[model samples]
Target: MPRVSPAHMEARRRQILEGAARCFARDGFHATSMQDILRETGLSAGAVYRYFPGKDAMIVDLAHHVLREVAAVFRDASLAERPPLPDVILGDSLTRAADLLTFPPSLIVQVWAETVRSPELATVLRTGLNNLVGHWRVLVEAYQRNGWMRPDVPAEHVARTLAACAQGYLLQSALVDRQDVSVVVEGLRGIMSIDAPTTQGT
Candidate 1:
């Protein structure tokens, strides 16, 4: 048998993951079987199994992969000499995530739903959330240093809030109405523009 190059192996792995993502996105994770993935990829059962042992492994791997890619977008933006504002950073990150994922962004809704039944998936999601939040914290601190954000507010709090905003956007996009990235970004900017009224001791 001819030996396969590392690049070829990586390509094969990606092919399997992409096919799996499509199935998961179209049907819920529980509904997508190994046979479905094999059929989608047009690869033999042996070939698909060579990369992922089962659907659970594929789900966890896919979640991690998507999260890392999304986090990278924020990481790169945060490291810029003149980092953009929170809204711009978020809009860009979400946009990049939507573009990069082989499946619909709404697919995340199904993954989150599955976490209730799968501890492994839940753990992977928590880790991924932490990783993404860490990058958001960096971005928040950068904003404060640049005087774009109030220094009095805790960076950690702001970071989590930003994460929540992104989550809410995804949930709404999936469950409610599909809105453009700009709409959410504009809302963030509007909220940021408001000046809180001073509260005297009462």
Candidate 2:
């Protein structure tokens, strides 16, 4: 018997994960069984199980994959030579967030539900959020130091506020059918705008 190459193994894993994502998105995670994934992937039960032992493990891997994609976006933006405008930063963030919607909104709902039942998954999400927000906080502080952003707001507050805004955008879009991304970008710009102080005397 010929052994599968590493690339082939990774491809098989991706196939299984993709199929599981569709299953979870269409049916609630609780309702999506291994059989559903098998049908979706056109793979045997053994093949699917070879990639993931159970639904919970598959969901965990999917959540980690999604979060890593988001984290990569933040990491790239944070490494820019100069801080980008708030609107620019948020626009890029929202674009990355949109990737989460590649499947039905129900997929996000399922992930959130699982987080409640699984402390480990919840911690994974929390850590990802912290990493994103911390990167933003550093960028915000740098912008403030360079007089590119409002000094009146605390960097940590700004970071959390922007993170909340991004999450709110995601939640609203998932809960609703439509979203005006421009509105969100503009709102973030407003929040991070630099203030010009008036001279008391000339």
Candidate 3:
């Protein structure tokens, strides 16, 4: 047999990762095994190891993949707006996440659970989520400079607050028996708005 090129190895790695994500998402990480991935991707044990040395590597990649996907969704929500306010940007984001769940729930939820058992997965989750919040802070500051957010509140504070709320909504939507996205949006709008009649101040 001929040796495989680096590009071929990378492609195979991606194929294995994609298949592993399906398995991990459906069965949870601990329950999944190399044999499961082999069945999912139709590759032999040696073939799988050629791309990923072990199962932890695949899960680390899966955690990264999930974070990248959430970041992309919020990034698209920002780009699609004509002149995006921080509120609209966030609202669009939660709405996008809500829609994504309707089709197939994200692997992020599974990844979060698996992190409890895997230190590498936990580290990936911590680092990736920090980076995501950082990107959001940058976007919030830009919107503040454009007068899209209130001038009094610090952009970083607003960014974290909104991210916390949105993350909570992700978990809540999974549990609750409702489709009240407006509930989240309205609550967030109240948190930021100064003209709310009752507590209108800096």
Candidate 4:
């Protein structure tokens, strides 16, 4: 094949992004330097910059990419053929939540902390947070429509509270043991009158 022109550069950017995601997830947003991405992806400095203007851009891409990937996984299952109310919340949170927490829980914590330091990162974080919760919250609203939930409790409130609790647990788990997530997840479940949530497969 002839040498691809710079027009194809965006594809290469995504390639480096994969390496960034791996490094960020394995290490952290701050720890994974541009050099780490270069060595991991075997791309030159100029080439990396051509794709992402700076490290902040790379971090933004990583945050958006991972959140969208997880959201797709949860949204599909949660919106699929299922029961109502409680099942929606469990389906949305359990499988992917456990995986995210068990592995790259730091990703959320890092971005949440970064909001204080970086305005751009904070903007990206807010948008990503809204996207994930908004996507999952649809399922809950559907359940409410079918009379599966109490009318007094709004689906948006449930979604936001759950999002807040889960995000907090990810951050707090760093100071305490990861096992402590049980308390948070259980507490959230109690509010919905459902059994505790688990990342484990059914």
Candidate 5:
């Protein structure tokens, strides 16, 4: 047999993942089976199993991949010479995430729901959340240093709040109301425009 190159192996793995993502997005995780992935990928059962032992592994890997890509977006923004405001950074990050993921953003809702029953998935998600929060903290600290944000508040607290806002936006967009990401950024900009004094003068 001819030896396969690393690039070819990676490509094959991605093919399986992409197929799996489509199935999971179209049908919930529980409803998607290995046969469904095989049919979607047009690959043999042996080939698919060679890359992933089971659906659980595939879902976990896909979740990790999505979170890592999303974190990288925030990390890059935080390292920029002139980082964007919290709202802009989040909007950009979310936009990047939606574009990068092979599946629809709505699929994240299903993954999040599955976390309740899968401890491994929950742990992976928590770690990913922490990674994202770390990057957000850097941006928050920068804003505080520049006097754009109140210094009295803890940076971690602010970071988590911003992270929560982003998650809420995702949930709302996916479930409650579908709107452009610009709408979210614009709303945040509006809220930040009213600069109230940290302490009222006597």
Candidate 6:
């Protein structure tokens, strides 16, 4: 038996995950079956099973991928060379939010809905959220040190508030498309004292 290269293995795994995401997006996770994923990927049942044991496993991986992509956006924004203004950060946040907002809200909605029923999925989400919050807390503190943000508000409070705001935006956008998110960003700037409202990007 010949060995598969690491790159090939990773590519194959991503292919399965992508197909699963599309299926879940089209149909709620509960409604999506392994066969549906197989059909989406154009892979045989055996091939699909080789990568993911079942639908539950596929959902878990898909959810993690989504969370990680979101988390990376925050982490990158935090680490950028030029410090980002609050409005700029907010805009960037929305842009990232929009990326996850893709067609068929059911993808995210399904995973969110599943947390109540699946302890395993719940843990994955919780851990990913905690890590994201931690990153934001650090960023908030950095902003405070440089007087870019208000010092009166606690860093943890600010981070958690921003996170909550993002989730709220996601929910609203998922329900009704084309919402004017600038107002929300302006409100956040006021709360955080993110100066230079004109600042566009990092």
Window of ten residues with lowest summed lDDT in model 5: 96-105
10 residues in a row with least lDDT, candidate 6: 97-106
Model 3 lDDT per residue over 1-202, tens place: 9998999888888888888877876777778888999999998998998778987898787557556766776666455544465567667666655554432344556667778888888988888768767767777877777776667878778778777887787667555544477887788778767665647579
- Model 3 has an lDDT value of 0.72
* Cα displacement (Å) at residue 177, model 2: 1.4
Q: 89-168, model 4: which lDDT tens digit per residue?
A: 44455446566433455555666677898888788778877876786577667677777765677778877776776566
The candidate 2 region of ten consecutive residues with least summed lDDT is 192-201
What TM-score quantifies how close candidate 6 is to the native fold?
A: 0.81
Q: Residue-pair clashes per candidate, as listed?
A: 0, 0, 0, 0, 0, 0
**Which digits, one per residue and each the tens of the lDDT, describe model 6 over residues 1-202?**
9999999988988888888888777777778888888888899988888888998898898778777877877788789766676566667767765676444554666788889999999999999989878878878888889876669889999888778887777677667775667867877778655354645787
Each model's lDDT comes to: 0.88, 0.81, 0.72, 0.68, 0.87, 0.78
Query: Which parts of model 5 have CA positions greater than 4 angstroms off?
Result: 197-202
Return whichever of 3 and 5 wins on lDDT: 5
Tell me the tens digit of each residue's lDDT in model 1 across 161-194: 9999989998998888877999989999999998
Worst 10 residues of 1 by lDDT: 97-106
Position 43, candidate 1: lDDT: 100
TM-score of 3: 0.71
lDDT (C-alpha) at residue 97 in model 4: 57
* Number of colliding residue pairs in model 4: 0
- Which stretches in model 3 have alpha-carbon errors above 4 Å? 1-7, 72-83, 87-106, 176-194, 198-202
Residue by residue across 69-134, what tens digits does model 2's lDDT show? 877777777788786766787787777767654686557777887888999889888888898899
Question: lDDT of model 4 at residue 177?
Answer: 62
Q: Compute the lDDT for candidate 4.
A: 0.68
Whole-structure CA lDDT of model 6: 0.78
Which pairs clash (backbone N, Cα, C closer than 3 Å) in model 6? none
